[model samples]
Target: MAVYQALKTAGVDAVTIDTANGFRSKLKRDPVDLVFLALHGIGGEDGTIQKILNRFKIPYVGSGPQASSLAFDKVKAKQIFHRNGIPTPRYAVITTKNWKRILKNWQTPYVIKPVQEGSSIGIFFVEKKQNPAKKVEAALKKYDRLLVEEKIDGREFTVGILGSEALPVIELRPKRKFYDYQAKYTKGMTEYLVPAPIPEKLTKSLQIMALKAHRALGLRDLSRVDFRTDARNHPFVLEVNSIPGFTETSLLPKAAAEIGLDFSGLCLKLLSMAQNGSKEK
Candidate 1:
């Protein structure tokens, strides 16, 4: 709704359709110049809708089908990060067969989550001496695979990517134990510091690393790369959000705003990018 309103306020002829039901029919009935996706999770960000849009020869904002799929799957994204020499947290993929063996050797202070989930859903943080057996079993039953990652016990930050540029870094201070689904969505649960009070050198480095991760995943247009640091301030890429939230107060827009790009301007810029991409193809 925010994206739609932004486009409308900017004098762009935009319409919204329910991708859940009869979206294809609506597209056939009413063709639009471009698609500005504000979706997340499986069928939305996991390349399902992107693939469909590609088959229809419809240009859309954000990354392509392959990049979207690769970034949406945590395991695949981590693999790309490793191959590109990008620093990410140590992680292992656990399946039903090998979960027991993997968990047995895992260090205490680790995280368990579904391989392809967003908004920090299905995430469990196992602290020292806490029995994670029940959590692991519950997760395995729900998801085909889980990711066990070494916890970076330090500050959290995120960098937004716009076209070929990286926006200012934002520091996230979640009041909860971690930035879970609740902290992310609820008001006042997490405090955001734009341009993150870190040293200028560290900020620049994080921005560069963010762009590297974005390109490494073959993502274009826009993305948000999340990071966590150790006590030594060594950064590790957590994951890449191919289609990040698109609201006025969303993290990406907040960063863009610091660089003088307002919400409506950001929306128009993305629309123009999609149009240019359509012409190129």
Candidate 2:
């Protein structure tokens, strides 16, 4: 609803349509000149909506279908990041055959996540001496594929990319053991520090890496790159959010506000970027 208020505050003639309600056919008939994609998760962030917009020749904000597809898949995004010399946590793609062996030899405190889900859905952490069979079994019942990653134990941070520039780094401190679904959505569950209280050099390094990760995936317009920095000050890229949230606690708006850009102004700026076509090269 924040996006709605921002659009109204910006004086943009906008309408909301939920693709989840089987409104694809109805949306194609709408005579709107531009589209601001605020939808997220499976059908929306995974390129399905972007393809529909392309078929209708509708100009939209943020990355194109290809970029969206590449970034939405955690395994594919990690591969792209590694190939491009970007530092990301070590991970293994699991299947039925190797899943058992992986758990047997796996180190404690590892990270487990679904290969393609977002908003940290079906993500869990296995601490030292913890039996992961129950959690793994439950997740496998719902998802055929999963990613087992060596958790980067350190401070968490996120970088916002707009156009070709990287915004200020925002440090995240979750009150829980880790930032899970509840920590992300529940109010006061986490704390954010803008322009993270790290050394200036490290801040610049993270921003540069965030931009590199963004471009490597061919993402255009705006994106948010997450990270985990260790005690040694080494930062590992976690993942990229193609269509990040614009809620009251959203990071993009927080970074934009550092430069005096209000929520309504950011909404207008995104519309301008859409009209100008910040399509991936």
Candidate 3:
């Protein structure tokens, strides 16, 4: 609904198409000049909607089908991150078959989460010497696959990429243990510091690393690369949110506003990118 209002405010005649009813049926009434997808989670962000748009030769904002599919899978994204020399936390995949012997190389105070979920859903942070029996079982039952990753003790920062340029860093301080679903929403639960007070050198390095991660996954147009800087001040790529939240207060928009691009102007800029973007892969 926020993106819808932003598009209208930017002088674009945007249609509100709810996928719950159906995407094709919503567009059957009139021809769409462009498909500004704001769909989240599985059906939209996992390349399903992108493939549908490609079938009809419609250009849309955010990433293409391959990149969206890649970003939705944490394990695959991590593999690509490592392959491209991007720093990310160490992780091991777990299932019922190897649940008992999975901790051979893994230590306590680990972070366990669903392998393919977004919004930090099913994320568990175990403390020192704590047994994660219930957490492991719950994650496996829910996601079928879980990633037991080493927790990075550090400050959290996010780098937003608009077109080919990386925006300023935004630091996230969550009231909770980590930036979980509750901290992300439920206003005042989190504090965000834009142009995070790091040295210019570190800022430039993070921006370059963010662009590397973005291009490694073939993500284009717009995306945000989340990071965690350790006590050593080393930045590790957490994940890339393709088509991240777009409200005036969302991370992406906040970063854009730092450079004089207001909310409505940012909307128009993204729309212009889609207009000039290639419809055919």
* Model 2 stretches astray by more than 4 angstroms: 278-281
- Relative to the unseen true structure, what is the C-alpha lDDT of residue 62 in candidate 1, on a scale of 0 to 100? 86
Give the alpha-carbon lDDT of every model: 0.92, 0.88, 0.87
Candidate number of the best lDDT: 1
Lowest lDDT block of 10, candidate 1: 272-281
Q: Give the least accurate 10-residue stretch of model 2, judged by summed lDDT.
A: 272-281
For model 1, residues 33-132, the per-residue Cα lDDT tens digits are 7899999899889889988988788999988888999999999999999999999999999988998888889889999888999999899899999988
Candidate 3 regions with alpha-carbon error over 4 angstroms: none
Q: Can you give the lDDT of residue 8 in candidate 1? A: 92
Worst 10 residues of 3 by lDDT: 22-31
The Cα RMSD in angstroms, rounded to one decimal, for candidate 2 relative to the true structure is 1.5
Best of the two (1, 2) by lDDT? 1
Higher-ranked by TM-score: 1 or 2: 1
By TM-score, the candidates rank as 1, 3, 2
Put down candidate 2 lDDT per residue, 175-257, tens digits, no spaces: 99888888888989999999799999999999999999999999888999999988898999999999998875698989988
For each candidate, give its TM-score against the true structure.
0.98, 0.96, 0.97
